[model samples]
Target: MQITASTVSLTVDDVAASRAFLTTHLGYTVQAAADGFASLTRTDAVDIVLLARGTEVLPPEQRDQHATGLILAFTLDGGLQDQEKRLRDAGVEITMPLREEPWGERLFQITDPNGVIIQFVEWVTPDDV
Candidate 1:
């Protein structure tokens, strides 16, 4: 079986607020919005979706108790600096600041209002060609 495009979706509290934050701050466009549910699309190559709830959203669980440390990461062609600037301009909170590691990857993290962690990274190496 061949898996094509996919998205991680979840209902969120305050659909309008989430919509505004994602669209205005993240450079995402509205793919669909109505009836208390909103779907957004990322402008980049990946078709990432952000879904907001129609009714009251769930409150965040107590940290270290949730037991799930799931995070989404994307390697940007422009690297960490560009994405850091983009996230900053969009008013997203930086959960983890960018720092170089011994693995030759520059990475940073940000969290959405719903607490989804998004890491933007770039690989570093000397280019001979």
Candidate 2:
């Protein structure tokens, strides 16, 4: 089967808080929203759906579960440093400072208002490693 798109649904304590954080800081646009739900989208990233914990739209067994132990990671084409700098300039606390690994992977992380861990990564050329 061909997958046209992808989406990640996160159950948070405050849907509005997570929605605002994504749109305001992570360049996501609101696809749809209601009292306790929000669908956020971006051209270069996966779609994100924020559902308030306990929302009935979720399965009964999952409705009360909160998003945890997950890192929403995005691999970028380039400009990892500039992106981190811009986020820092916007007063976003970098939860994980930008660092490069021996395998040429560079990454950093920030936590959204709902405590969702968002990570950005970029890989360097072998020559630059």
Candidate 3:
């Protein structure tokens, strides 16, 4: 099957809080929203759907599960440092400091209001490795 689009649905304790965090800080626009759900989208990133914990739209077994131990990562083409600084300057707490790995991966992380861990990464050639 050919996939046309991608989306990740996250169940959170507070849908509005996660919605606002993504829209205001992470550049996601609201595609749709309801009392206990929100669909967010971005031109350069994956679409996100936030559902309040216990929302009936989810399967019975998944309704009460909050997104935990999950890290949503986005790989950037460039400007990883500038983006990190921009978020920091905008008052977003850098949950994980930006660092480069020996494998040529540079990354940093931030946790949204609902505790969703979002990580941004950029790859570059590491010298002497």
Candidate 4:
């Protein structure tokens, strides 16, 4: 199969809230939007689709489910510290402070209004595995 792109669909209580957060803070632009749905895009990141919980477009079994226990992580080639500082300066609360692991991974996390965790990671050394 030839896949051209990727997207993450999130079932949120407030689609507008999540949409605004992504556009305002995360450098995403609204590609399209409607009463209960929004499609956001960032040139260098994965596209995000926010669907209001219980929206009819979702399958009956999935409509009642909300996005949880998931972390939307972005891996950076460098500038992990700079990115963290920029986010902090922009008044974004750092739920997980920047920390480095013994395995040469550095990461930090932030939670959006809908409780979606966004993690930024940088590898100090190339993965050996």
Candidate 5:
């Protein structure tokens, strides 16, 4: 199948809160929004759709489900440390402190207002690996 773009839909307790967090901290712009739904977009990242828990647009059985156990990760080419520092300087709490693995992968995480885990990763060539 042909995929032109990608989006992750998150069911959240407070749609507006998640929406605001994406816009304010993650550089997302509102493409569309209503009382219980918001579509956010950024040029360099995946699109995100926030839906209030129990939103009627979902199937009856799925309407009450909230997003959990998922990490929305972005893989960057470089400058991960700078991005982490910027986030910290903006008062964004780091849920997982920046750490590098033996395999040359560096990553960190932050939880959004609705508890969605947003992780940033950068990979390098490990001389030993």
Candidate 6:
């Protein structure tokens, strides 16, 4: 099926904590929020949803194990290091520090409090080539 939109609902230990990270660090606009769940829309048209376990949106058993072997990656343009540093300053867990690959793309990695990995990247310019 052609997926118009998809949402990754993560079970968080604290809903407000997850919301703060999603909004402040990841730059998501909140579409809706309640005691048990929060729906968010990324400016880049990405669909992301966060559901608190044992709540209306997701049951305790239905909550993802966070070991689903999945990571939510975002291909971003602009200054990779600056962005990575900014995120790091904002309390995002920089699981992998910013570094340039041998192939020459500047990239960095960070994961939210919920263990969602995000990749921030920038293309190598001619001067770097």
Candidates in order have lDDT scores of 0.66, 0.94, 0.94, 0.92, 0.93, 0.72
RMSD list, candidates in order: 5.4, 1.6, 1.1, 2.0, 1.0, 3.4
Worst 10 residues of 1 by lDDT: 59-68
lDDT string, candidate 4, 15-128, tens digits: 999888888888999999999899999889999999999999999999989999999999999999998999899998999999988788999998999999999999886366
**lDDT for residue 105 in candidate 2, whole number 0-100:** 86
lDDT (tens digit, per residue) of candidate 3 on 1-129: 999789999999999999988999889999999999999999888899999999987999998999999999999999999999999999999999999998899999999998999999999999967
Stretches off by above 4 angstroms in model 3 are: none
TM-score of each: 0.68, 0.94, 0.95, 0.93, 0.95, 0.74
Could you tell which candidate, 2 or 3, scores higher by TM-score?
3
- Least accurate stretch of 10 residues (summed lDDT) in model 2? 120-129
Model 2: per-residue lDDT, tens digit, 29-59?
A: 9999999999999998899999999999899
User: What lDDT tens digits, residue by residue, belong to model 6 across residues 6-52?
Assistant: 77777666667778887898778889988867788975757777766
TM-score of 2: 0.94
| Model 4: how far residue 43 lies from native, Å | 1.9
| Pairs of colliding residues, candidate 6 | none
